[model samples]
Target chain A: MSEAIQPRMIDFKPHEIPLEDFDISQRELWSEDLKMAYFERLREEAPVHYCKDSEFGPYWSVTRYADIMEVDSNWQDFSSEPAITIIDPEEDFPLPMFIAMDPPKHDDQRKTVQGSVAPANLKNLESTIRGRVQTVLDELPVGEEFDWVDRVSIELTTQMLATLFDFPFEDRRKLTRWSDVATGGPETGVVETEEQRREELMECLAYFTRLWQERQEQGLSNDFISMLAHGEATKDMSPEEYLGNLILLIVGGNDTTRNSMTGGVLALNENPGEYAKLRNNPGVIPNMVSEIIRWQTPLAHMRRIANRDYELGGQTIKQGDKVIMWYLSGNRDERAIENPNEFIIDRKRARQHLSFGFGPHRCMGNRLAELQLRILWEEIQKRFHMVEVVGEVERVPSNFVHGYTKMPVVLHPL
Target chain B: MPKITYIEHNGTQHEVDAEVGVSVMQAAIDNLVPGIDADCGGECSCATCHVMVKEDWVAKTGSPEEGEESMLDLNPERQGNSRLSCQITVTEELDGLIVDLPEFQF
Candidate 1:
């Protein structure tokens, strides 16, 4: 057994560490050396460390699983208003959705959008979504290498989301780019020029505006956008508000699911025994889906505002203070998950992951996300004998979203 | 058996026999209604069981409790007649109660 390292104070002021020192654009979230170092540090001192200065601002980072659950569940104390990401919007472009709002009004806006993506609606999409996944996989280049992130993961998820909104098929990739710009700006790669980012945002809004107008002119249909366009939520949704909700759904549904697919395949490649176990017992796909979500935890963290002064983990949190719940860390909490680090498919409590988040603001598209993942695995198993990671797996630089930017895999078809 | 009617978001109505003493949410789940998930198992924690009480059946269902009221504050389509299905217990008087499913419940 490794000895537990003693707790020591380490200041994580953002400004103290220059942005250039951290390769935010690199595919590996942390260089392998850094990842191991940080995980070790988290297991020891300051599981709930405070950073004095970050690019966004000073905030508390809740790294433990139990601590994240406590904060996520207790929304009365830790509100979802002001902002939901660690980087303050003023310092960066703001996320326009009301996922950041608090009670009363938050409830109203949520109700409007919830009508379209509820579980029942998701169930109806199962076969359609599954078929779409199969179709995407069926077209893959048999023995050749390709950027799985772009060709498979992004294409499949973006198409599914576009189908959900009844968007034109040819323009679906735009949805992917917009979401990339919206969430990818703060983390790494080409920092989108302010004008380029603005253009993308406007493009997204204009697309939704046109859709809303068409729906209004015609009538409500089966699509989510139509449902939102004519439903109770729209009674008060201004053009901008409608566009904001559309963007929220697109982002919520896109990266998280795409990453899980990429992550699940990558995890299987890394653990061949587990992959063989899955191939032998196809019955374990459902459980395996949950495990992948837990292991990958595509969305790393979500921020909440303290409604009032409260105390947690022996520290006092003033009202309106920012609290960052690291869901990735929470999903691997040693207290909540057994053998937290290992990728165990049959672990009974695997579904109890913070990846979908918890409480009211939990993911709206969780069921759809899971369905897509399960189908992807099922199709992959039927068509391919093996998936080998031919090269290094790249991770997005931003702390908010976690997943590969480029995962080159060579598919071996049976 | 009490007859209850559920009008889905698309205006499709499902009429079924509901047992007395079970909440509307339980009735929907018992009948395998498509939209009512009740993911939190009727704890009023997840707003998945949200239903709109028909105007005529308001008195039979009674007003939402303080907790239900607060919980409803988190729902997106909350209306004047919005009630959490878990909070309402079935009674013979509510045999013909009508409830409408919202278009979305995440």
Candidate 2:
């Protein structure tokens, strides 16, 4: 609320806008929830549309399901280095995390910590996650309106993140604050200035460094700090690199799931049929989790730099062009998904969506995310008849982190 | 049509007839077999369609190529006989093929 985003689009329908004038990367469109119409137009007319100018500069939008798959899977052709968002990496304060790095290094670093959050490992954490979900649900006031985003979504995700990192239980909100600062710039009001953002992040690194040293002195444990401290590939990382990976894990585990949590409740309220379907058959929660992920599309787009001149969707993209794979757009592609806009609780092949991206860079926490959501919904169904939305839902004003800011809700018992 | 037997983790076996050219992943999906989730469709990009060929039938299924190997390598559950079903095309040579589905798809 520090400053209003500069208005870029006039009151014209997305279809009325000239194809050349489409630059869907603007933050205003995301906050206003008007980016979908723009993406719909791009998918129909120009699956691989290029915007000559945008707030983030020139970039090409891969708006189709098949085309996004091609770009995301072909890492040799389109690299993730330098940056993974439309905004270029800060030159002075470069964060060399593996998500933005290409193979060999990316593979090695990812594998070292990957074991902790892998699906096999998640089975052991299921009870712990379920207990936390139950605790959160049990504490909420029945029939009383409250901010669901803060009470349930943020509370549950932050608690789970704390358990994963072995972070301090009382100071868990710091993880939420840090996740926001890492992805958001001063423009979004996470901090007053660029320097303040860096300073807070440094404080985060210093805090984690203490835990890393403590873990290094002990036997290898199951927590993330212990895994990183003992991991051969990650043990030698520099301070900046460690901070980069920390930010990556925090944001990856936090904002994405938090949004989906609120998004699912909102979606269920909006579509009563689906909510009824969920009530009748609680077994559909697992499938509904995938559908919710697709519907939310927590991260709207992942940017890549073309490594060589490649022809995609009948357009020649230069070697140095910035390419954005709009996962939100692809998840709604009618060509790939049947009735892409509707939220069907029992949609077949629900997991086949670009929300996680694909190939090596596909989300490492996909299973962990699913497990949490499954447990939450399963527990929610057992207790509440309906978690009714009571008022206006506010959304986060960033195209990169597609999520909610507030959703007021009240729980009703069966 | 070649006959493919997909054994789920819980010992449930689904024997389905497959077309001559579709993938083993497609066969399971088409037959409504429960375990395999070919998230990438028939593309070798996503290793979600992971399956372990029964020891007796491993040779007939053939080894995974380099691209397929890279995808399978990303999975922590990958075993020595592990393969991406999407990479395995159905054929007469794959008749009576038996593949064991993992407990979970990565």
Candidate 3:
């Protein structure tokens, strides 16, 4: 007798399954083409959904834009203490960053380094970023396929991060690896086990500690490491706190921008008409950058714990209930954005989406992220006629970091 | 191009030509004016670019849109004359506009 064949979960179409059976938290759901289909269905049928059980345990998925805004703004009711992922941070390994803290503490720690990416600082860093971007682009082999994610996005962002920390340039790749390890889980292929993840992150902490001491000896400096070491609020942070904040800065600077960089290329290749529009008028690069970030919607969701009984999206969120605000889903909400699915580079009010998040805990380095993207697009227009995607784009497996692992592309010189 | 004056909270003033059709935030950004953070880059999603329109130019600058107003509400010190510079487009009539920059963008 022939062995019974079982259908693979990835083979199941989202539409084939009943709405009641939908569970968006499954890491497998993020990798399949049905990801968006599931989000679309959730937005239409159950904007505020409850998954009774999943890998990350039962949680409420707020899929609509207005509801997400409510969750983001009402921090008093929805707390971000401990950690901000669907899977709670391990009790043995507590990493406390400012984004996961509440009120006065969050404000104090945030202000410690907010000036680094302030508009004035960004203006100063513009020329340096431009030079680095040019060098990265100029070095790429024209008309030859390469992984744009690694060769361009990761390299450029890692370089910038190294500059921000004043770290040794040759060791810059460690920043990229650390950023990946920080957010990646066992399924992402970046790490095989939770023990391995913790081990790698401890190495990261030790390395940063050495840099912290070195920066302290040099007195105050504009670089992030020195700033944290000197700032009154951040200077005395615990080792765990330091590691948490370092991971925050690394992932914040690395993943979002890098993914959007890859996403932009794929987006343009898929929407050639929009690409034509952008090529016709490179002046639209600034607006198009926002559109790319919006379309990509990196860092898929941020989870918060309900501090008190609260009513949201016509549902009562009981105290201690885990509420996840799916930023990717909200960015694609039909009610919030016009023609949210299609990639439109010239969309008026393009920045109306929620990629950088909203309210007080909104990304501090958002301007820096936008500046990096804007410069890259502006430079791309100058040198390349097109960055042709030559192979299937590989996506990161984790549901948290919605990003590309590899993308083959060949640059076409103008 | 329309000339505009930006008065920082510390009393430093910047006088620059505001490119017609661009937002006030862009003009400040172009001129390196210190206070308009425009962190969301004129998305109307952030109130970092909050400015107090001069009394005479309040009518010309216009009121905030509902979305912009909602974001402005996030600012605890949001005043009657408060306007997100990014939401106010530069026009011929907006020439010689003077706006007071807030002390903190957060």
Please give the DockQ score of every candidate, comma-separated.
0.21, 0.72, 0.13
My TM-score estimates for the predictions, one after another, are 0.77, 0.97, 0.84
What is candidate 2's lDDT per residue for A1-414, written digit by digit as tens? 343554555565798878999988887788789999999999999999989998789999999999999999999999999779889988999988889999878988888788888888898999999999999999999999999999999999999999999999999999999999999987776788889999999999999999999999999998888988998989999998999999999999999999999999999999999999999999899999999999999999999999999999999999999999999999999999999999998998898898988988999998899999999999999999999999999988898999999999999998
- Which residue segments of model 2 deviate by more than 4 Å? A1-10
lDDT, residue A22, model 3 = 75
> Over the stretch A1-414, how does candidate 1's per-residue lDDT look in tens digits?
112222223434433454323222122433221343354355355666666655566787777877777787677889887668776764344455668776657666667666556666677888888888788888889889998999889999999988888999999998988888877542254343556766778888888788878977887787877777677755557665665677778888898999998999888888888998998998899889989998988887899888888877877878877888878777777777778888988776466677877666777777677778888888888999987789998777667778778999889997
Write model 1 residue lDDT over B1-106, tens digit each, in one string.
8888999999999998989888889999898776776754565555668899999999888998765676677554578999888788888888888999887665
Highest lDDT among the candidates is held by which one?
2
Error of 2 at A200 (Å): 0.5
Q: After superposition, how far is residue A66 of candidate 1 from its true place, in Å?
A: 2.0
Instruction: For model 1, give the TM-score of chain B.
Output: 0.95
- CA lDDT of A372 in candidate 2? 91
Candidate 3 structure quality by residue, lDDT tens digits, B12-79: 99999999999999999988888776655666666778999999999888898766766675455578
Q: Candidate 1 or 3, higher lDDT?
A: 3
Per residue, candidate 3 scores C-alpha lDDT tens digits across A337-397 of: 8899999988876866778787667878877898999999999999989999999988887
Give the higher-DockQ candidate: 1 or 3: 1
Model 2 scores what on Cα lDDT?
Answer: 0.92
